[model samples]
Target: MYLFKKAKESIVSSLHGDKSSPIIKINYICNCILKITLAICLWLSSLSFLALYLNADIINKSLFQLFSLSSLILSCLSFIILKRKNGTYILAKIKMYPFSFKDLVDVSLLTGVVTISVFDIILCYLYLLVAFAVFVIATCSIYECLDNPYMRDNENISSFSLSFISVLYMGLYVISNGVIFRNLPYNPLEYMGYIIKNIIEDIFSVTKKLTKLII
Candidate 1:
């Protein structure tokens, strides 16, 4: 806890873009706790599914019950953590999207769509959901970081261009790599796709820099 506080203070000072004296480190420990807990819960949920698939006799009924319990616990934790923060209000002041119920719904839908597509057998929708989720999440995250009050440089058009290109690269990469190979499921091709995505992503990133220069 002390270390986290210290880290937050340091980050605040850095964001101020100066050697500041006193910085009231935002006490978002509850958010951090919930985020970590959420990750664990998700991992456990995935593991439960895997277990059910591998050992249907033992895991069939229990898997559903465990998943339900986990979901409930995670929901309670999220509600408790978000209740006081009201991220929407805080984020509005910064001219950015604050974490809210909408984001939760989006993420839930994304996860469901991705998992079903990736793990389903016949009649599978392929990896479209994973690719789409990756694109959307990456876009939102980049936009948020670029628009953040603590770090944005409104005067620099280059910054905006760079962020824009970064998002495009991420979107393209995920689309090509995720959706294209779901049915085949080849190891070497999957690896190649990943490599190609990175290359393409980097290539497109150069365009942003070029555009910045031209603009």
Candidate 2:
């Protein structure tokens, strides 16, 4: 937020520059902060995700591992494109607000995803998606009686990388009434799947019985 506010102020100030003040040149670096960010923070984030997947039982372990490894490699590759020497710009510091807006946004985005992965928020959100999808599918199938005109259930993956970043960096996972993922650490995959399936089916069975009154 501070970065955005500063950037916004810089833009407005630049448009109404004082002709009275003389212009000065500053050593200009393109995306210097992002270069530092990828070289350090994101590199660590990738390795951290890799370490987790290697030790923990991820749902799609191999793909997750590959994603992490690829990210780590990409962060390494960022150095190849780095500027060899600083360029010059007129009042560059004020013009760029210390760094480009994109640089800070990228940092924030990477940090958010890493936080989610580290805190296991992704796993929690996965089930939330599953439950929402299940409910939507069920309700949509019975839409005529329910009078819901908005009736569509879709998953965006095979067709879309979901901003491409999603499939590549922060992968999306979906389960259709499957085992709770966190349970994999404790129960056998098969047993866990069975438990969740039964629970969902039983809930629906009861719902079906009660819905007879609504119909």
Candidate 3:
């Protein structure tokens, strides 16, 4: 009983702690919504992909459209909430607070677990895509938090490395998803060559477009 009371107090204190600022609260809420939406998308994508793979006629077009629309709406809502609540104007004034990248990772893991439990299947590829989306959002939030002039001096190499890796992972996951969506032949070793080739081509294409715009 004593331990339980102490634990309850700890929980309350943690929620009401100084780290629980308005911006942090908004970030958490937005992340939660995005995580839920990503889970739905993963489930729907998995179903569709499996149906396509097995030549099953179970693909319900109406249901797929509904899920896709909901996912898009929720994704937009998360973005709007973060922007309106922590717009550049307000973010500029905030000093460095205790931000936990680990918490974001934990949320991502929880999302994957819940998605699998609810869907009763493991769609590794789609799961990676969903996680990539989560990580991209997390990376953006970290960037915004670190954008404050106050944090500029305090930023460390480790945080920057993590952000860079998150972006890299997002890009790879997107490429993998594209490959799978196109129903390309995927032998791990062989498919990697294709993935790398496509990535290089995409980089050159983007660079060309940017150069044209600059000129």
> How many residue pairs clash in each candidate at the backbone level?
0, 0, 0
lDDT of 1 at 52: 50
lDDT value, candidate 2, whole model? 0.36
TM-score (C-alpha, index-matched) for candidate 2: 0.24
Off by over 4 Å in 1: 1-26, 59-64, 67-69, 72-215
Q: Which pairs of residues have clashing backbones in candidate 1?
A: none
For residues 1-215, could you state the per-residue lDDT of candidate 2 as single tens digits?
75555455556657787644322211212234225535543554455474554556433334434444544554443343233221112113222221122211211222322111212222223323432443343233233323422222234221121123332222112231122232222346654565566567667877998999889
- Worst lDDT 10-window in candidate 3: 95-104
Q: What TM-score against the true fold does each predicted structure earn?
A: 0.24, 0.24, 0.24
The C-alpha lDDT values of all candidates are 0.39, 0.36, 0.40
Write the residue-wise lDDT of candidate 1 on 1-215 in tens digits: 43344455445645675322211112233244334445544554455455455554531243234443443454344444345334322212111111121211211222222111111221111122333343454465466555656345565433343344335536445443333233222466655665566556666778888999999
Candidate 3 lDDT tens digits, 1-215: 43344455445656677644544544343345344544554554454344334443322333333333443543444344334523221221111111211111111122222111211111222333445555555455356436634435443433343334334434544654443334333455655665566567667878998999999
Candidate 1 accuracy as lDDT: 0.39
RMSD of 3: 24.2
Weakest 10 consecutive residues of candidate 1 by summed lDDT: 115-124
